[model samples]
Target: MRGDTSPADGDKLGREAPIPRQLQQVQDDDLDPDSVKRHEEDDDDDDDADEGRDEEVAGLVPRLSDEEERSARRARNEGGAKLGRATTTYREGDDDYDDEDHLNHVEDGGGSRSPFADRREQRARRRKPAGVLATIWAIAREALPTLAISVLSLVFSGELLIHLARWPVFVKVDKLFILVPILLNLKGNLEGNLSLRMSTSANIGELDIRRTRETLIFGNLALLQVQALIVSLFAGILASVLGVIGGLGGASEGPKTAQRRGFGALLTKRRVIHHHPAPSDPSMRLRNSYFEFVLVIATGMLAASMSSAILGSFMCALVVVTRQLGGNPDNIASPLAGSLGDLLTLTILGLLGSFLVRFEGTILATLILLALAAACACCFFLAYRNAYVRELLSSGWIPLVVAMFISSGAGLVLDAFVQRYEGFALLVPVATGLPGACSAIFVSRISTALHSGKGVSSSLSHSSSSTLISALRDILKLGPTEGWIVPATLFTIGAGIEVLFLVLVWVTGQMSFGWPFAITFVITSGLIVAASLYISHLITLFLWSRDYDPDIYCLPYVTSLIDVIGQILLVVAFATATVLGDQITAAVNDHQKP
Candidate 1:
């Protein structure tokens, strides 16, 4: 019956398009208590029929046309007379659509309504469910840009040109093939850790803090870093022994030695899967601080030993500096603190990484990386067993963070061994494979296990899904809210596209060549950083407009994309630029002959 009405004059759609405020006028007004008391005493069959009619009236939209107005009034009258009431007391008034009036109501200039009240009501309307199919469809549609970016990156990275130019270099470096994958894994791991921490923080009330939480997170990172270094040290020793044995066997020692050296050199790397301990509650939050610190110390020692005996002391000093500096309360502030701190931290870390890359070997690097990884695993398991930590950090961030840290640590260790023994530069590719595959596998398994009827109650799982679906259905049934998801969704898509392009450049062999590689790297890096900022800005903006859950769901996916691209870039960079001399020589020779 409500659907039969046509749009009224001065109304955009139907009746006067009530600007939300007018719809709640009844609730705001005082009710006649004596009239309500008398209606509660009625018990006639006619009263029951009138009650049904009154229920129907309640279903009608509060904003009405003259037609709806008469119908509701008639319904109320019939319902009331059956209860022996004199008449139903009601009033109908038209709200003039005035910008000034709306502004005043919203600004507190008019005490009639608080600005937040109408906005809250609108949000409640928006959050109602649209349905399962709609929700799934929306999610899938939203992911299209992400999928497109992946495809594009795979296609257009311009790597063929670089590969063709640097064949000999590829030949020379082919033995250390594990390097690319290792780097990508590290990047993803680190980013994933950050996301996990963010998500976990969001779940608790600690997402925004000035000091305590930041110190803990920084300490954890340092610990993880140190543990990685320690692991690399052990790996390097093993690699050296194998290299020495192979050299003595009289094989092409050039390749063997190179493999060992390269393996050791690639120690100071960015891992794809990094873990960030989320501060869920005070206890686990506090515990992670100490745990992460321990991990960093262990990793640092391992990596230093493995990578370079020459710079071992320097590397240790760097770790100590990082640990001490990172622990400073001022160094690690709330996420919103000055970019100066982050810039400083980045500079210090980058310097250390550069130093390590210049002198470190793959075998040593891998050992330290693995050692740190083991520490991360131990920390996670220990905390998981404890109820307090589990409760605190057990949100969307933990799974991804844990998966990334452990996988990255494992990848680095394996990469070191691979480089030392195999002379295959598998870094970029392996980074894409190991952490991506393993994390996805782990997530899938966990989701399945949790959803399966054997362990958990089937009814509970079903109920939860059903509730979500129902909520979505209700949301869809309500008209759309102010178009906030539009811009947010667009930003997500744009970032995802940029990510794919970055990956493409890395994969297409642009990363290996001299100038082209450099250009590609800059472009890719800028896009990633920009995209992240844009997403954060848009999400925050949308949240102000409507209640949108900024969860870790997108973080892993984004980090994975970044990791893949970063590793691909590193591999291409090394592979393409190695033959720069040859290219220049050939060009010069041709020019001279002409």
Candidate 2:
């Protein structure tokens, strides 16, 4: 087959696969661009636009055979390049940068247009500004429904937290508040990262073969199990550390505070304000208990491991199905993974924790924790044995740890202002999650484009200087012509969702904010999502240029950053509503007079 090398050739090359016939032909002066287009056309007959992009990149960007595709992923420090005809040169000096022409840069090519070139003469003409508009409209038409469903699902997670907060498991369990949000944040990152990576793997033809598909899917699933366990353990430790701080006199608040949201507290006869439910026996300091510490770890590990297993498999299958159904998984997978991860992880933590709390000091709890450790170790061994995910065992830890620290800092912001306004906690998901969902989608698309080997064969594919150039264009350039179409469409949808969230809260009487605060909420959330989309673009470029896997690097930090930013924006929206919302202030005053 001209598509991939034979099994014997793959063995002879060790880990690297051979270049395709069209790519090798690029070295010959007799190479015909039209012929290359024909081969690709037969391979992807349904996609008319990608034909041009394939022809364009074949003459420009060079790809490696690698140790990981046939074995595509190589070691982090290893630069295993086998250029066919074109050459790439990265310049640090500003002089080499084409300030005027974003797409033309350091390339020794066989007369191929860079995948990222904003060359209006060739591409922009066919896609008139109207075509660009239509392009984004098509993207929006498919994507908005998925984004909406994902965002709506977060309400269940938020509601779960609200309902589960008052459970005795939370009271008896030390720092469950501190533990749950961190686990959810970390787990969300893991699942979203899995979705993004799977989408990239699938689009690049990595999963086209049954053998390769099995390796990638199973290896990644094993890898997820390991990551989830480690991250869960980290969550338990952070909660303990924060609980220690609370004991020594700093306040620790988390998703549990969401339970006390709304102004109903203002009208209630008794003033009952506490970070978590007070124990019936005031003498017991739950935070200091040895058993509580072990249970916290147990609960987090159990919940995170189970959630990752469920969400990771679901993400893999979903991406595969989306690809099979002739849809881009990039449009749907990542956001849904994030939303479902949070909801599933939280629910498991709450319900399982309640059951486990009954066995806290017993041998049963200890046995369960040990068994989980053994199970995670088994998954780690499975991950290490697989060529596709072997390296992941060592990679991606720093980002996860860093994200935890960030989300932990966000706890301070949440603790300070969560009780200050009505429906603040209820709205946290839609506010923060909408932007995060947008960023995950953006990051996944950039990652797929950046690593798809075929250059920007589709809107989902990028290369070095060209990659950065296109990232800027794709994220920033707008209007009827060029890059603005997809981004603007996503932002438009995000803005609509943001406004809808506020309306839902207000109409349901869960919150009372006047025009001023409603306006503030819309403006603030809009900016946050805009910033999130742009930041995802930047982070993906940064990681990619460094030769690090952007799939692992991009999604985690963006989601965590959104957590902090979303909560701060919520507080700002609330502060605005409390001060400038005459309707709210009047209601509070009226209620107080009675």
Candidate 3:
């Protein structure tokens, strides 16, 4: 009835078998509900002839005229566009999609509907913090053995003083009490820088120990040795000047005079004692001044050279081992360098001073000075040739020298106080070494963080209160463990070392302040270490905020500050220990009387 052709065309199409009524019914049922309803209404309007025509058209794959075919293709394309729009809407309203629909969509090769949501989920999983106990255990496992070795090394540093006690030069030169600590602090500063440079270089793959001469490692090593020589020369001259002025005040008395005059007289005597016994001798004073100068200078040179050689070598090995173990050398190298520098510098100074004092005016003394000068000259020439060495010298050396001078002043304070408190003298190395080591370690860690481009953000350059808060927050984030755990661990280690140091003193028959004094010393040393670490952290953050390199600016000042603070705290601890011990003794006496 709706055919374009006549009855012949209809009959020709009808020659093909028609679809069964059941299949036709299934096909009609599969149509959209609106389409099926419209078709049923259309059937009611057409009656039987039209109904038969609709059944035939539905049963067969209806042929389309050219215009109809074009329209059909356009409709199909429109339906495809609508399907794409529906998929986008479904993804945006992901909660509206059933889990089965989501599964079918994925199974059909559609990617994750919400990629951003998936990424957020992944980030949430990644950002979880480790448990507190686990973090503590990890840091302890990492730090304890190294810290133990550091403490042992610091304790051994007392051997330097013990050996110096055997040296005539130590007694002959009045300024050595001031000079020794200065030189030890200087050596620590230089070597600590070397360790930092090496650790940083190694971290970034710049350090190649096997080919050190061609690498930055060689330049840093050269810089360290040259700086050591230069600083040694400066320290020697400064100490010599102090010695001369000290001689003017009758302070350069020999050990024999000190022993004979009693501790009070020895400390109060302001004139240089001439080797000559007679008091009416002007020549005696001039000769004694020259003796003090030569003694201080020679001892300074020897100490510096020995420390550079031994500590430099030790630092190289330390860097290599730390790198091989995949541990951060910054955390351990500074303390190791500091403790070893103290032990070796003091011990070497004593040994060389003992020998040098024996030949003070002899040709051997002249030969030693000439040799030291020659060695220093050779090292300087080599350092001058290196570009990195030159840069380090220009940028870094002056601050270090200034810091050493300040440390020398701290040493002077210790020397002045040593005569008043006998136990104080014995505790000086422990007081100075432990806190210095702790601060040095922290400085190294902060320096490494700054270098590695972590922790400190560049936005902190504003120096505003908000920026300061941000900078502090960055520091906390950098080493959250450092704030509490590190300080506590350092305090525990320091207390143990203090106990060991006092025991060593008592065992060696050096000085016996007894158990109450020991308890005071332990508590004080722990407090000093905690305070020093906190100060170090503050200094590091301040320097880092200002875009200053903490490695060069921080270690020297911190170590020097620790020396001053350690000495004051030591004195306080001694006073507290004495009062507490006296009270305990009085209580015991009163109880016994009852």
CA-lDDT, candidates in order: 0.33, 0.67, 0.60
Off by over 4 Å in 2: 1-130, 248-250, 253-287, 453-482, 576-581, 585-594
TM-score of each: 0.29, 0.70, 0.64
Candidate 2 lDDT score at position 399: 91
What lDDT tens digits, residue by residue, belong to model 1 across residues 76-122?
33342222111212111101112344433322212232343345345
- The better candidate by TM-score, 2 or 3, is 2
The C-alpha local distance difference test score for the whole of candidate 3 amounts to: 0.60
Best by TM-score: 2
Better of 1 and 3 by lDDT: 3
Model 3, position 83: C-alpha lDDT score: 11
Query: Against the correct fold, how does model 2 do in TM-score?
Result: 0.70
Candidate 1 residues lying further than 4 Å off, grouped into runs, are: 1-122, 130-194, 203-594
